[model samples]
Target: MSGSEQAPVVGVSTYRQRAVTGVWDVEACLTPAPYVEGVTRAGGIAVLLPPQPADAAVAAAVLDRLDGLVLVGGSDVDPALYGAGPHDATDPPQRQRDTWEALLVHEAIARGVPFLGICRGAQVLGVALGGTLHQHVPEVIGHHGHRAGNAVFTPTVVTTVPGTRVADILGDGVTAPCYHHQAIDRVADGLVVGARDDDGLVEAVELPDHPFGVAVQWHPEEDLDDLRLFAALVDASARRRTGAYA
Candidate 1:
């Protein structure tokens, strides 16, 4: 390997289609540049996985090739996926993404693949593990300060549980940038809280028994200055590739 060679590759979610307001046909495979750029900056390769045909077999094959999985933040997951009644704020899910990423999360977890999920990614992880969601965190909990409208990408103060995976990586707390209107309500069968807000929302989940699994209700990828997270995931992926993360 050359002096500048990078480590094992990691797969990330892609935005292939989306619903603008009430319209659902405006397709887009969008993603924030920082996801790829940050991974590279941390000496890891980034691979994009579109949200379609993401079957268990396909995911196992991909997991075999890659060392880690990163779930990027975007879109509102269908409230119905978690057995919730119709949400007044429910937006049409990017069906293409819904099926694929959901499958990817299940397959990755089943195969013991190291993984990290951000924002909507965190919500998906919960549902995939047979849990539920509170379609709108503020609507039910009335944690009005959790989300700031108009300029949706405001910051929230998340206090992590001491000794949890997140606090161990990002210190005892961090002010993460959030844009999502939905959050995990049911604590999932295989996941546990790594942090929470004053409102008692599940701000993060960690698979304490899995090789490496963690999810956060914020856009950690958007903050390039937070290389601790980027480095942690890359390090986990490298361990997975070397068969040391088991």
Candidate 2:
């Protein structure tokens, strides 16, 4: 295939796991299969990026080879990263994943790479950009509608802000599969709210100056029917790879 026709490489962040798969319990780097499926379905080369050393150089090297990034959903962000104390409902933070993904977020921003962050990944993007999180959505909303239970994907109606990229892509009044317990509290500088739920909770955000930097509180990967978000990232990556952004 010609260089311009090559599929854009999209890197996806993974979760570290300790699982018993057979006779032995082992530590492993893993990501949800749906994330890969979504990226591949969007015509991009999906590359799993497991957590690495918390070094800027390493993160930069990894980003240098990719055209786009997907920060997959996982554990809660460490409150300390946003200068807040953890709430009782907050899950124990995954410090290692936190450190590594934070580096990736920084590098991706510095390099102007297109990225999509889902759930916890969205929180990471927010914190990395000097934003704070709600810590516990139940406390603010007084309901667990956003996350009915563990391993459950609750459906919620989210309205996109008119004229925002999210509205342009998903249109207004979108019913999305959501399973998040925390939400952005203080939106970061330069990032604008792209969508929100009926409760007026922030559901999505975008960086106006970025080529394609969007993060959503819902798990788009769980919604197999809609590949628009993933496709947007891939399209942005393809543009970057072919100098369309120039």
Candidate 3:
């Protein structure tokens, strides 16, 4: 099979990580290896997109080449973007990454590219779509079950709405690894809630009219065993490349 017959290209955004590489301390663009592995396992070519200057042209250029986009999990979004003040528990914001990823999200949506947002990625999608966030889940939910601590993933049970894309993919009742402290507050107009937790917190969303746009508040990449979500994204990317949706 040729390149066109092979898996579609999926761009995964990365966060800035400070590291010591070969005795040189430097800031690096990085994401968990599983983000790449998950996409590959789902038969999609994974491309890591590091934080770039807040340039719409650059973002559009990147989106032009990608069949899909995966907004990987990372730091909290800057509250100012949604006209809110920061919460005490919210982590210090990564403004540069926020700007870059926000542009990518908007560009991908405008181009009708299939995209998946995980954790912070999901929050970014909501904000880009003219939505707001809860800022801190615990404050409203009255618990920290969503995020136990730093570097820890909690097992979460989410229920998908009937006849929705999430329910079609993962069924109604599904359990996945979750590590988030913020969630969608005021959902955007064109989007609809696709899944929720037992606490009634929004867990997933989908843009029904779009070719494929899903954002989940969990880390499916960490599941490793379940590639259904990634596979769905890859399939949608293939369809987009083939002009099946146009």
How well does model 2 score by local distance difference test? 0.90
Residues 1-246 of candidate 3 have per-residue lDDT tens digits of 886466789999998979787988998989999999988888889999999786999999999999999999988999999998998977788888999999999999899999999988889999988999998899898999999987789999999999889889998768979888889999988888999999999999999988889999999998889999999999999888878875
Residue 64 of model 3, lDDT score: 94
**TM-score of each candidate?**
0.90, 0.96, 0.96
Clashes of each: 3, 0, 0
Better of 1 and 3 by lDDT: 3
Q: Write the per-residue lDDT of candidate 1 for residues 1-246, one digit (tens) a residue.
A: 752353868898888765464656676666778888767777788888877665679877878888888888877887667777767877777666777888888888888888889888898899888888887777877665655777567687889998878889988888888777788987888687999976778889999987779899977776788877778888888888777855
Distance from true location, Cα of 94 in model 2, Å: 1.4
Specify the poorest-scoring 10-residue window by lDDT in model 3.
Answer: 1-10
Query: Looking at model 1, which ten-residue stretch has the lowest summed lDDT?
Result: 17-26
Candidate 1 deviant stretches above 4 angstroms: 3-6, 18-27
Query: Which 10 successive residues of model 2 have the least lDDT summed?
Result: 1-10
What is the lDDT of every predicted structure here?
0.80, 0.90, 0.90
> Which prediction has more favorable TM-score, 1 or 3?
3
Question: Any runs in candidate 2 off by more than 4 Å, and if so which?
Answer: 2-5
- lDDT tens digits, residues 73-176, model 2? 98889999999888988889888899999899889889999999998888899999999999889989999999998688999999999988888889876899
